[model samples]
Target: MQAEGGLRERKKRETRAALAEAALRLALEKGPDHVTVEEIAEAADVSVRTFFNYFPHKEHAILGRNPEHLERALERMRTAPPEESPLTTMWFIVHDVLRDLENEGELSRRGELIMGSPNLLYQLMMASFDDERQLTAALAARMGEPESAVRPALIVSTAGAACRVAMELHKNAPGRPVRELVDEGFQLLAQGIDPAFGPNQSNQKGHS
Candidate 1:
């Protein structure tokens, strides 16, 4: 019974991956607005009904990878040693995942496609914040702390900002590795903003 269940789960995952890949390929070839659900189903070698069973719509197929990536990152964070700081553990795991995306030759294409489509870009941005909230909650639970913990929120927000910065850097420096961009962002954060902005003094007159 266990073996059969495992096999069934594996098959479902494979089918889902196939469907997502097919949708992305069709979108890239014909433009996202031109592709139909039936066409995506045909590209994945599945029926329209089967495609719907895996993904409710074409956009979901394209955007589902983000939640999947976040889940994997959460799993890594859960298993990491207790001695590791949450930020460090998350950074290491996320960096590895981004590196894998780069090595698969999918990052550039995926990034370009998302950036080109306003709808897709909006969807991704919303999903990213949702993932950040989920990660923060998961980390709080794993640490046996309350979700309202300031540290968790700070870590999540800072990490998210770093990711955004890294993505922008990647857009400008396509030849550079994502890890390098991430490291540079973290380094800047570590150096503190005070050096760039000066201390607490303000230049505004009559503001105090």
Candidate 2:
């Protein structure tokens, strides 16, 4: 029973990934406003009803921000080891997505599409803002701090800024793995940026 359940879940994930990839590819080929749900469904070899089963709308597939994934991410962060610092815990969770996106060339194309479409840009911004709030609350509870505390807010926001910079760099130079840059960003962040990079600390390691 457990094996059958696991296989069923895997098949669902595969179908979801196929739909998301098709949606984004079509959105890039046609303008974001021009693509239809039926077209995306056809591209994924699925019915319109199946597309709706995975996503309420076309934009959700294109942006890859479904509620299930978001909730799982927040839960992972919230239940992270007590001994691990928030940044360390976050890196493991986020790096998996970055690595997968980079492998699939998903990040660069999504970045391009989002920048070209005002509607997508605004939607992404609003969604990100909402996600940050939920993540902040989750992290706060894990840390035993009030949700309004500056530290939790800073952790989520700073991690977000680092991801944006990493994506831009990845888009510009596809050869360099995004993880190298993101790792550097987080390392600098873990050191609080000043002490490790102070004028007195002269010796430097070569860039990744």
Candidate 3:
């Protein structure tokens, strides 16, 4: 029964991936507004009901924000060694997630899709805000602090900003590994985001 259940879960994940990939391909071919859940389902060889089961709307399908992926990352963060700082644990979790995204060109395609659609870009920002809020609450729980505390909110929001900047940089430098960019972003954070120091001191001073 356990094996059977695992197989079923695997199949569900495959179906979800298929639907998301189909949605992105369609969006790329014929803009996000022109695509429909029914068309995506048809392309993925699933019914519209199945598409709805995986994603609430077409925008979500294109965005490809799987709740399972988020839960998996949260689980990793929750189970990290007690001695590890929350920020360190966050980098570990993000590293694994970004590694997966860097596979099979899907991340690049999704980035292109977002850049092409203003509405999709807006929706993606809103979704990111939701993710930030969720991570803030999770970080609070991990720290055994009240959810209303300001520290967790600041940490998670700052981390989100770092990730966003890394993503933008990665989009420009497509040949470089995204993990390296992310690491550089975190390292800069660790050194404080001041312009007076670091390898780009001259550049930073000029900007200042």
Highest-TM-score candidate: 3
Per-residue accuracy of model 1 over 7-37 as CA lDDT, tens digit each = 9988988888788888888889998888899
What lDDT is obtained when candidate 3 is compared to the true structure?
0.82
lDDT values for all models:
0.78, 0.82, 0.82
Q: How many pairs collide in each candidate, listed in order?
A: 0, 0, 0
Model 2 steric clash pairs: none
Model 3 lDDT tens row, 1-208: 9999999999998998899889989998998999999999999999999998999899999888788767887788678899998878778877776767667368777876686678988898898788778888888999999989998888777777777776677677778666777788888777778855566777777999
Best by lDDT: 3
Q: What is the Cα-based lDDT of residue 139 in candidate 3? A: 89
Model 2: lowest-lDDT 10 consecutive positions? 199-208
In lDDT terms, how accurate is model 2? 0.82
Candidates in order, TM-scores: namely 0.83, 0.81, 0.86
Put down candidate 2 lDDT per residue, 72-167, tens digits, no spaces: 778789778789999887787677667667677787789767766888877877888898899889889899999989998898888877877776
What candidate 2 gets wrong by more than 4 Å, as runs, is 66-68, 103-105, 193-208
